[model samples]
Target: MRTTYLTIAGRIRQELTEITQVVERVQQIWQLYTSTQPRGNEFLVDATALNLHSFYAGIERLLEVIADRIDREKPMGSAWHRELLQQMTADIPGVRPAVLSPETRTRLDRYRGFRHVVRNVYSFSLDVEQIVPLVRHLHAVDAQIQRELSQFADWLEQAAGAE
Candidate 1:
């Protein structure tokens, strides 16, 4: 049981790290895309927009993993990412629910929409308008996750110290 708990904790840490890096990259790209006035070839901007969507997809995957691990002892389960989030909110008091605070929920919603677009290979192009909002949402989610993780880490440390 201890080993299982340790493993899950390690995975949560890993996912948190990945999410942070992705959020940072998304912010950097957003800065680059928004700094200058619209000019030059449209294709380059279009490609960058797609890349931004891809980064959100990556964030979604990480969140899904973290949520799943929180709910189940093992990670090998059905794709219950959404269900897991709901269960987490309903089941775990304070700790896990902190992971899905309002800000995080907004980011997840935006990511869900972007994921749908990417999965369907939708032709709709993303402009600075969409990217800016998404980046802001992503940053908010990142902050929430960081705060939650810190709390979680503290909890783990206290538990370990007790043991």
Candidate 2:
């Protein structure tokens, strides 16, 4: 049976798959970035930074889809990225529970800043120091998002079943 929860959850699930792909690709890039000797491996680092940028981009895309589809609202203005993340932590009165926690919000906020830097600067200009923590901690955010979304999906499935 078709239901609102199924439709919403279906799309979010597809997004999680896309994020998994980004995670795989980012992992490969990180391996290349780390294994190569730092002395002569500008290319590897640059590749990693680009992929890191993509990682955040993919997550933002997923959030945008969820915001538009389930929340029925798209943030407006120059700071929409921040607002969208904020929205995820909010409980919309008649809509749905917050999709993620405030702690996740704090972590994702860093990437939001990183994403901005990646966009505004050249890849070669990326600082290895800056990218290091993001790479190191990527899996934590990935897991957190996966766990949160999975629970949401279960809730959605139950809602669908009830309907």
Candidate 3:
């Protein structure tokens, strides 16, 4: 049981590191897009759209790990993606604290919705107006995720020690 807790905590920390890399890349690409005068290039817009999709996907991966490893239950069905995101906001008594705050969940929900649109529609069809705000708020959302997950990792470590 101690080993299990430590292993899960390690995995969470590892995933957080990888997610940070994705966030940095998103910031770089977004900066390039914004630096371009007029910022209307179709290709840059497409790139930003893809990065945003990747960002949300990375976040979902971390949440999935928490659901499967810690929560011992994963959501099922066509709406599982949304379900999984919501799961992180739940405080499962005696199991684990909520991995995300409701505010963070609300911000991330936007990215999740955008991710679905990115998957279903062609890149050129993406709305720059929508993507712009998501990119602008990326840092705030990422900060919340980092803080929450880091605290969760601390909890895992403490639990391991207690065991």
Candidate 4:
């Protein structure tokens, strides 16, 4: 059980690292898109698709970890998983506002829906058009999450010093 927990934790950390890298790359692409003012939209669209794919991949990995833990009959592990999810959600501000931001919330909700489809429906595919907007929203949320993680790290350091 301990090894299983460590394995899950390591996988989660690895996925988080991948998520950060993809988010950084998306930011770079966004910068290039805005700075150069590219003549054609094709490249920009392709970059957006790639960014979305990475974002979804990260989320899928996270859900997989949660599912694995549940399958192993480790409900306590889910508390940490839920905390991470809540932190991810709270880390993004306007991206998924507590109230009055149905569209943003729905975009993320689709991920959960997709997980359900994977687990239950078993015959679902992601269409490009359906995922693009969600990716755009995720880009916005990624910025907020980056900021939140930085702040949280600083808070942790300060608390550790006090103790």
Candidate 5:
């Protein structure tokens, strides 16, 4: 049986909360790094990498739920992650509007790529330069995602009530 729209909306809100937590942790790590800049702590750098990974992972989790429940299908294969992201930008006739804007998808793709690198490499090997940009942009990305997904959730809730 298909999941109820309200149920999916609740899941989306929960994932948004999780993503916010991840963003907060990443901000903390960035602040710590800046305070001790010249010293360059490896642990802080590694923590940043992990939190960044979590941020993208949370987003992917939200998208996966939408794709499965609302869209009625999830992409497959080794490139499914990228495929799923792409899928969210397409407005499906008679189903639902696009879950993400193209700009949001583009911004998210950066985190997705970073998550891939973090997964394959040793935390110690993570470059501070790479982590810096993602950390700086985290807040903006978080805000955009929160706005987009919350709007989507609102739509789901309305659809649920009408059923």
Candidate 6:
């Protein structure tokens, strides 16, 4: 139905908006990380970790929207994050095509693991070393997500127009 495609297109737009917020937050975090004088201070490190956590949180939120609207599944398990990512890359039965490539999923797993760490620990305890790599790669992941979502948006528009 065209309504289904329209729904997906609408939700994708929402996710893209959320992605913008996520990128803004991540850029802010990266700025804090870079702009700190003599670096590795307590406040900067703690705030950056929390902000980095938000980056992954944003990624998950968008994926949840896609799953709920398009895949019609959200996976239930102790490893639901992994399942959710896999779901995004899977072709749902006559529902919709995969929303992410395996490569993007792999890149996203890094954020997923960081998100898990952020959840279980106190922010002050976050290691600067571990956080550095994710921060460094943040733009790459964000760009990939943007490119992929743009393609999906085009697909949704085409699907909607087919009615």
Q: Tell me which of candidates 4 and 6 scores higher on TM-score.
A: 6
Screening candidate 5 with a backbone cut-off below 3 angstroms (N, C-alpha, C), the clashing residue pairs are none
All candidates: CA RMSD (Å) = 4.2, 2.0, 1.3, 9.4, 1.4, 2.0
The candidate that wins on lDDT is 5
When summed lDDT is taken over every stretch of 10 residues in candidate 5, the lowest stretch is 1-10
How well is each residue in 1-163 modelled by candidate 5, as lDDT tens digits? 2247888888889999989999999998889888995866889989889999999998999899889877889999999999999999999998888999999999999999999999999888888889888988889999999999999999888877776
* Residue runs of model 4 more than 4 Å from their true location after superposition: 72-107, 110-140, 143-163
Tell me the tens digit of each residue's lDDT in model 3 across 1-163: 6887788788878887887887888888878878988857778888878888888888798788879888999999999998998899999999998888999989999999999999999887888899889988988898888899899989999998998
Worst 10 residues of 6 by lDDT: 39-48
Query: Model 6 misses residue 124 by how many Å?
Result: 0.9
Candidate 6, residues 1-163, lDDT tens digits: the string is 6787777677767776777776677678668768878776677677767777777777788788777777767888799999999888887766777788999999899889988998999887787789888878888888888888777777878978976
lDDT of the structure predicted as candidate 2: 0.81
Clashing pairs in 1: none
lDDT of 5 at 58: 88
Put the candidates in TM-score order, highest first. Answer: 5, 3, 2, 6, 1, 4
State the lDDT of candidate 4 residue by residue for 78-149, as single tens digits: 344333344334323322222113443345555544443334432223343654455556666654444443
Counting clashing residue pairs in each candidate, in order, gives 0, 0, 0, 0, 0, 0
List lDDT for all candidates, in order: 0.56, 0.81, 0.87, 0.49, 0.90, 0.79
For every model shown, what is its TM-score relative to the native structure? Answer: 0.67, 0.89, 0.93, 0.49, 0.95, 0.86
Winning model by TM-score: 5
Question: What is candidate 1's lDDT per residue for 11-48, written digit by digit as tens?
Answer: 65776777677667666665665665765445445555
Whose lDDT is higher: candidate 4's or candidate 6's?
6
